[model samples]
Target: MASEKMEGPSAPAVRRDPYEVLSVSRDSSDQEIKSAYRKLALKYHPDKNVSNPEASELFKEVAYSYSILSDPDKRRHYDTAGFEALEHGAMDMEIDLSNLGTVNTMFAALFSKLGVPIKTTVSATILEEALNGTVTVRPLPLGASFSGKVDKQSAHFFGVTINEQQAQSGIVIRVSSSAQSKFKLLYFEQEANGGYGLALQEDSEKTGKATSAGMYFLHFQVYRMDSAVNALAMAKDPDAAFFKRLEGLQPCEVSELKSGTHIFAVYGDNFFKPASYTIEAMCAKSYEDTTQKLMEIEAQILTKRNDLRQFETEYRKALTQFQEVTNRYSVEKQAVDELLNQREQIHSSFTTVRTVAGHIGASNGGGGSKAHLDDSRTESQSDDGSSDGKDKSNKKRWFNLNLNRSDKKL
Candidate 1:
């Protein structure tokens, strides 16, 4: 009988989305995950809802959720595991209901002893390390973001997978619950490679958001329009090329934003040239004005330089002429100096000869006639140039000396 029951096949395992466990999307920040866990833990704390059995069960469920997410190896396993794999791990060796009551009793003291505000902080420590993740294309939750290691070459993606699970014996397929729009949050990738792309063969999806001038991912579900054109408009996209590329797209519903993990895909088919995408009239005009302004600034800089050069050349020429005049004046002053020196020497010699003759006449006490002396003086005066003319020339020479001294001082 035991063998037959075992052969009857075990119940299908409940697949748990890693994103759902954390109550965040693939793009969620470490802080966001910690915040979500704190809220959930507080709401389901067994001590807070002692009368509610459901709350008790939920408390344990949340504890379990925190347990897995807090570990790196476990989180990775949970992320990649399909429904079957997750179910197999979900199966405990045996059920234990007693742990819940004991865990609650220790919660307060545990928080205090550890100096932790909440259990979320415990997970946050682990999350700081997990930030080294790459892009994930798995289905994300509302306001959740993509979480995975980003690739250098490939575009990022957050995705959803649909599968048909068989539960009953050979029964036909049935539909599962379908999530609605605005179900997932948008996280703009930090330092994203510009634009988007789509791979025909991939199941990954990605969501992007605009933060500041660039893009980054954050936790929170956003309901964006299905049309890329509309999405760009809704975000008030700053990139003209990004908007234009959206216009060129063939209205793909697949490209539409839905509630799940979103990704940024970069495929060759999605590549666009500027001419291919149509841009808003205003945006194009704005670009033109921007370009024109840059050109005008460049022209103004060149014109200023040219004007400065012309002024410099004129100043140099004027300086050369001024220096030449200064040098010529120096030469003229030197010639005047030579003539003045010769006149001074002649006057000094004449004065010396007159003194000698007077001395000799005084010593002889004689005998020379007054008339004779007078005649000698008259003859000497006649041979000399006019006294007034020579006196005026001597005054002119003295003035030239003063002028030359002044020029030297200058």
Candidate 2:
């Protein structure tokens, strides 16, 4: 029966000889070759062996062999260049095997110029894992946290704006950095009318606990979304006399800012450990309302901190217990090693005694009576049994001791 199409290159591919596939000798005669192809083709023809993909493939393979062997030039090419000669020609051919009407017609392209099929198969397990969501791909080189003191760095400046048409809702912008992370925040704002505005911009560089003290820098600007770009431009050239024309544009220091679309950038620095900060925006009816919301958020944050502390305490307790157990194991192992040494000594002593007894017995007479020899053997056997029993008892004692210590440690 024709087999299924040999599952293609789905399995790991191994190079196979075309000559072997055709089962023809290198020196086979042209007539001998035509006879071989005709016989195989009749048996494996897709029409005759319906539903058999393997038979179809075998049919194609045989036709390929016959085409090359029938022509002197192609046969010579195959003989000189090997199967690669077929692959080279196959790349240029666009012939479709399924449309060929008969075995004779199929022989022209099906064998000599068949399309090259992709031979790789993906593992089902990997595909299933991906579908199950167990696969994780990290496109970023590193996570958010960075190590060692970082220099002045800037992130992509994202523009945030407040709608002037909806001026009833004031805007609150907050920037914060990690504690002891040595990062600080600086900000500036500009008006929509091409005028710079005062900002709660603070000194950007911070160190130690001072980092948290200057965590956030707030700013208020005229209600224009693109004011962020103007503010950035002014900050870039703060000494420019043209920027000086914007009256009342000097940086303003305030604990709170008025409602407006404000744009600001943060500058962070540290001697060790890279620094990162978060920027946030909120809309409220008044500055007091924003402060109240901030108070409520801080309370929630405090609760989270308490939970983290509790977890840390539990971790410490577990670690201490582990250390204690490890120490006890080490002590017990040392004791067991000593006991093993004692047992070895006992075995050595018994072996020596047995050897000495055997020598003495031999010296007593040319050959002691069988009855006397039997008694001596019986005594030696009894001594051996007693020693073995003692050794077993010692093992049990150590085993129980070791278990008791381990249980107490646990």
What's the count of clashing pairs in each model shown?
42, 9
**Superposition TM-score, candidate 1 onto the true structure:** 0.20
Residue 255 CA displacement from its true place in model 1, Å: 41
Per-candidate TM equals 0.20, 0.25
Ten-residue region with minimum lDDT total, candidate 2 = 137-146
The CA lDDT of each predicted structure is: 0.37, 0.45
Each model's Cα RMSD: 29.0, 35.5
Which candidate gets the maximum TM-score versus the true structure?
2
Candidate 2 residue spans exceeding 4 A from truth: 1-185, 188-257, 260-302, 352-410
Indicate which candidate wins on lDDT.
2
Candidate 2 residue lDDT tens string, 276-310: 55555454444556556655765554455456557
